[model samples]
Target chain A: MKKIIQFIVLAFVLLPGVARAQEAAGSINDMWSFPVVYAYDEEVTWFFDLSTTTFAAESDVYLWIWSPSEPDAGNWENSSEFAKLTYEGDMIWSFTLTPTEYFNMTPEDIAASAGFWFRLKDLTGSLQSEVHSMAYTDYSSFAGSGELWRSYPSSPLIDEGVSILFNANLAEGFEDATSIHFHSGLNFWDIAVEYQSWIPEVVEKTQLKNMGGGIYKMDLIPQEYYEAPDGYVMENIAFLFVKDDWAGTTADQVLYAGEFIPPPPPVFTFFPQQISKKDFLGIIRTNNEPGINTLIYTVTAGTVEVTGEITGGVSEIKGFVNLVSALQNVDVTEIHVLVKDNTDRTISDTTIPLKQLD
Target chain B: MRSKIIYGLAIMGLIAVGCNDPDDGSYVDPVTIYEKMDGDWGLMSLNMVDEYAKANAIEPSEQNMGAYFNYEDFKIRFSVDDNMEPTTYEVMGDVPPLFPANGYWKLSSAFQQPNGEAVKIYLYSDAQKTQMTDELKLVAVPGSGEQMELQLVRKSGGIAFVSYSFKLNAVN
Candidate 1:
């Protein structure tokens, strides 16, 4: 019995060592974090693209990080269920954790450490991926940038997390405020997340995290925070920093969404190098603005008047008007053309001289 | 003997002249524009040009509309009688009716115009080809590659405004 007990103890100690010795299937193709930047105390998800690795799709993946402090230190051979990553499909896995809470270390310690260093492994700790480190965005320099407001990513997408840092010291009427809140909207208030002081949830959701010395940060995924409808195109976020239930508010601020490139201006024109009264006149407009699909045209020649509409999408709207029939017997020297888009915006109003056909 | 040698040289010269004759013993009838444009033609591309934009030197004076409005399946068949006279023209596909879909058609000239004037294809709604419906210009005659370009121009007063250029390939 004594020998058996000693053998069992030896097996328990050697089993982990053997499991740790198992080779990783392959290295992960890539890894990144949403928000791209986050504070140590904030919750962030580390995504691992395991497509290049031999890891099975949607397989159970667990974190085995060490630097910035390891939370699951003794749970390598049998990782805790909490350490298991959530499979995000396409051979990708994500582990969402607040660095401070996961490591049981202060934000300062996490910052001072060598960042997020880890390898991903299976439950048995046999199949693993190569070691990787998640880099931290050091926003410590923002304190001296002297800007009133700065977004972690200068331009932010609607669905991703964005950290908006505000320097209350730069704004007036924000001094001695108990709390700061974000009152914002997308596309110049086309959609809004109003800071309703009466609603407890709204009050809590809009409150900003005071970073001390009049520096505050508001971290939010714009889509989730605003509950924007499907297919909502976010242009620029119009916002203001409100202090303590609108006791005092800073001036209006705007942060343009990332990749919200404005479409090119619409171009309208008549077709053919030269025209005669006995030809079909073409009307065309390309690079039409959104909601400006149809172009209505009115042509005036002598005493005769003709009107028609050319319809298309954002790319172009083109159609031919039967001028061969419209002006068959009409004698004229020039024709006046007026073109307007579906939005009632006039695109062109001009006169074209006739090229007398011999 | 000298007389005989001169006669032999004259016979050889005649043979050489006969061999060097420029004309081959073959005759090919001239292919008219109607015959080249006959049969089915599939749309290779369709472009809309803005004449006002071009005249003013504006950007994006033309747009390729080949991919729009089921134009990829767009086909036009210009039929001719045994005498090679244009009989009836019909456009295939459920695309926009840029012109009359089917009609009796006749070309302004059976051959390409040589006076720098565009040859027009007159479309008529009546069987007798008297009631005119639309007209399209034969901008490009079918070449060795079985490709042709037809343009429909829109005009007001006497000035050309917009045009649609249809590049087509002969379908086997």
Candidate 2:
């Protein structure tokens, strides 16, 4: 009886240890909190969801904050050693730590500390989630050397094929900048103004031209990048400028592409291609779109031009021109109708052969 | 015995401090002006008659007076939260086909009614909200707190470009 009892006790202890040592199936799903890009003074409480797989009591989890120097290393600062995550409701583990607390630096040190990253790991430190980078920006740090402003294309609308003369004054530290990259994304305005997390596609970086003093300029022809079909209006195009470690992304500039649209052809009916001198020539016509300021109707009978203006938007406009006097001496005449808009765009249709009526 | 009594009181004080709940029962949701204007607002009808038309000796007709102003087959909706981006615009009309109405809207705190009776809301055509497409005066309908009207005015250099009076009925 004593031997059987010892075997049962040993089995209970060994089985649990083997099961706990086994690798867990799933990983951490998501880590979230308010104010992703934290200010120096703000205290952030991050809640990590571990609902995917529950571990045995013997198993453990950890958090690692990657330092700026150790870019390639998996294990950097073991945040779990200092701050242990307390159990929160709904299988979420909570840890309260500030940027200043983690880095041992205050908000005033953000200019030197640009790139920072963090991640969560298991006890063995083998299983982990993707690293989350921190993008720290402060008004003072952003305008470190001096303030910058953009001139030209004051409004967001720009004509296609025309080079936008983009001119700006660089800050003090940015004078040594070698290149400026252009980054763009569609529908940036639709992203939440406060927590805009969408990443923009970076276009190729090019060297900047120093145009005397502290002024810099770039003549960017948009058509080269955006293939806007004829009469097409591209919308929600967000663009920004970035330089090498000198300046952060400048304020976003959103623009609309306004290409020229040609006017549509006018529709009209001038029946009876052949007309008689005594018969009145009735010309009727209309345009698909409005804005017809004036319409001129003309008839030519070999070196003789007779014309009259027709006004208004009508599907059927019947007007009779008395060629009885003009064609009285002629045998035949050709009829023409011209339509025009306020912008000086014109379209016309012609009818031929007006034999003198017996 | 006296030292033990004093130690007991000190431990009890620490316990009381630790037991205090950070979240009090008193929590009120704030009702901001933007929340009131957030929803799907259908445009039933629109008319934009320019002051220049009257000066140009033009007749006051829908066709002649505002010939350039075309507001047909279009619907606009405002989002409630901070994610109210112009890209998420629910444009219900032919406007998006030709002139993409990636509408964005925001309330201008700078301009308010002198009497403080109304708020000014700025509307934009693109997602960036950089271009000022229209300016609207949002006011609650008389006697109806839930119902409202948006009066939009387009002007330039003291000349009336277009005046749009919209009766927005909430669909959502």
Candidate 3:
């Protein structure tokens, strides 16, 4: 029979890639009426995730697209469009066009006339609901995947060169001038607030119940990227803290919350650094996730440190004590830390002047 | 011989339709599974506590903002058939709040383990119950055990709720 339907579509195109990355979603519960299309002002608002599509006169839903279009090739049903709005029963059966008013009512001389589609509708009675799929705006919440943040406030404690300000929320990120650099193992830097670093020198975009959200990088202050270990409270929660979601995500899905408490030991940072060379030889790794076999270090000059190690044997934290041999000479001044984590649990801190930066 | 006596009466009607037995021996009568689970889980949930945050707060809550997402196309149809059991929730969205309209709630899901595995799944609340004057609290699974999980609170005018957490995935 057609070679058994081409061997079941060639075994689903030869399977594996984790089931083609399973998840285009289905059954998002229902009751949505979204309809906002301002498109820089063609005007039309209408949103409703809180209720309005209990659709019982024909049910099916869609109209999900956040930009990019042209896919279904041979233009059937307007060839895969996005930006549509229609319903049945209990109202809004259809009307709110505005892709410049539905392509000026008949393909108004075609030239990208706004669209975002999702409409199947088919109810009329018995209630039967089930049609969902939207909310994938090209992924990238730090590269797709969710929920893994857990809170950890052991009674407000994180020592070492104190300046500890990392209150979360950096919604819908990335704007060509990106920022958020804090890593471990190989030390790193970059987190300022009044001195603007996660690049929020000013960016504002608002729209709530309409989705496609964003808030852009806010409040980073990892003591401008690592060098802590003296009594560990780093300038108490540094200011300008607004990008509240990079790790724990909660712009209020009923106030979810979690993810932030990492910088609490013989500190260090990693990753984010696109340019910084007045003097850089970075890599100061310290992981005390619950290790405290007691380790210490000291350093301070105009900033140049190398050779530090705690290499992580199954990593509950192990060794690392070189601020480049505690900063060569007398011009070196401040950098001191003392850890002891295999339950010995000691803790110390210090760090603020690489010639007083930020 | 007469078609083997009608195939021996169709193999005794397929052995009485395969003898029906899913763990046989049962005495089910926990008041009909606690009245069909607190009576349909009190019309799905959320109705009170108004405020109570510091008993050493681990995540204790109650701040509903107008429980949106239910417009049964906006209906009131009540001349008096919600059995009049509201104790305090007032907004009158075209008028329909009196008696617990948003003030108190008390859920009770009886437990009974022995490997039957049930952590408070009782449900049934076509909205009407008594025996609670105040002090409202009822975590359920007979009272918190069976890997406990079910929390809902909010009554004193936090609007009513717009979005709380049952999280069916915003982007799993």
Candidate 4:
């Protein structure tokens, strides 16, 4: 009887602690669904950035969604295997689902309700992330817009997903095309994923999803879709939409990759516009690169030579040398100055004429 | 009538006492620039200026050189005789010789020039003060703050081009 009483006491003490631990660790940092735009019945993969949460990397994560509908209701403590998310490396997790199938609702029902809202959790609901919602992109307006093609994020990065919508009604020969395939390449055909209709896998992989009513969509993550080699820099994607195994095709098209603006160049200049042998010479450089913090300099006037170094960070490096004492009574019209960085890269080597003092 | 005469004499005596000059005490000798300048001075800042660039309105015409070549530890001392007259001057730190390190020194004027002309410190290489080495303009006289500024100008063809200004503070 005493053992039973002690067991009850321990259960009371530890149960609440376990309940508290089941609460959300943190909110998702970011959430996005591939195909940026999709129909309610179309398959899409929703990605979550869990880096900001307490969820361990590459851990088993499951979805517990409620609004639109909760197909896995009454099972929060033991999420179904179908709701399990695949762990993408780098603390990112993804779940691929068709809204209509996952919610067990009609397209009209899913669209009429509030968007996808859910918290990510581990099996048995012991640990979870804060509630988050996946963003939806509606592309229905492009049907009547009379545009041939449009992409969901006008510029796309190589590793991110991009959705390209096509208006077949506007194309000359796409009306009777049983299917459409993407024959694309990176950097103007430097690397290509050819649409070989003979290969069943290649044909299916390059096929576009027909959205009915002369509208179609092609979704891809450039890096994976092209199977580019390591360190492959994608400048632009060049391609055309082919119809029914070369029965017809659209004009050649190119989508330029996002622009990367490099940092401004470094600038070197002498402090004083004019100098004399009896004045201190100032060396200054601004907008330097990282780790280029020091400048070593050598100045020669007649038989006298002076050398020293100045140190600073990425913004600027500046110093002054005492020429008055070093070149006292020395006869010279100009002094040769050589400056190099800490890495021994020559920054400047030139002879500056000394201004005759009056 | 005798009472009136006594009152009148008292009034005149009181007037004479009030008219007498107030005692201002004896006169003391005025302080000279030599007395204020004769001491050990530590360098506070040393600036090199491009006078030609400044004349032409160019940017970055001046730079501070106090941190270079051991100038942070630089010191100068001026000695005077018991009469408070200028005698010898010496640079104390192991720094580059911007001027004659040790020399007999004298002021261009015993007192500040009333005409506003800058007084000069003339350095001589000999005790007899026959050979002149360098001259530095006393740009700022030592004031109540115990600080002074000296400028050495380099010139050619009677026009100044570059100059060095040394600002110093009394050590003790």
Which residue segments of model 3 deviate by more than 4 Å?
A: A1-130, A133-310, A313-315, A319-358, B1-172
Clashes of each: 13, 1, 93, 5
- Whichever of 1 and 4 has more DockQ, that candidate is 4
Q: Which candidate leads in TM-score?
A: 4
lDDT string for model 4 (A258-326, tens) is 864455799898866667776677899988876789999999988888899999988889888878788
Comparison by TM-score, 3 against 4, better one: 4
> lDDT tens digits, residues B32-112, model 2?
556555666665554433334445655431222112223344566667557432233455754312222556677765234
Higher-ranked by TM-score: 1 or 4: 4
> What are the per-residue Cα lDDT tens digits for candidate 1 across B44-95?
9998777767878976577677766678999999999999988899999987
lDDT at position B10, candidate 2? 99
How high is the lDDT of residue B172 in model 1?
Answer: 95
* Candidate 3 local lDDT, A1-358, one digit each (tens): 9999999988888886335332222232333222211232233333324134344333343343322243323333342334334554444344343444433433332234333434332222122224333221111232222331111221222221111112223333433213332222112122222222245432221101122232221211133333444323332332222222243222321111123354545554311111011112222345544333333333234554432334342233333222222443335433333333334444434443332211
Provide the lowest-lDDT 10-residue window in model 4 chain B: B154-163
Give the alpha carbon lDDT tens digit for every residue of A103-177 in model 1: 999998888888888999989788888888887788888878989999968898888778899999888888889
Worst 10 residues of 4 chain A by lDDT: A16-25
Worst 10 residues of 1 chain A by lDDT: A272-281
> What fraction of native interface contacts is shared by candidate 2?
0.00
Off by over 4 Å in 1: A1-57, A88-92, A98-101, A105-112, A138-150, A166-176, A187-190, A211-215, A228-238, A251-260, A266-358, B1-172
- Of the two candidates 3 and 4, the one with more favorable lDDT, higher being better, is 4
Docking class of 1: incorrect
| TM-score of each model, paired residue for residue | 0.62, 0.24, 0.18, 0.67
User: How large is the interface RMSD of candidate 1?
Assistant: 6.7
Model 2 regions more than 4 Å off = A1-358, B1-30, B54-72, B82-89, B96-100, B110-118, B124-134, B137-147
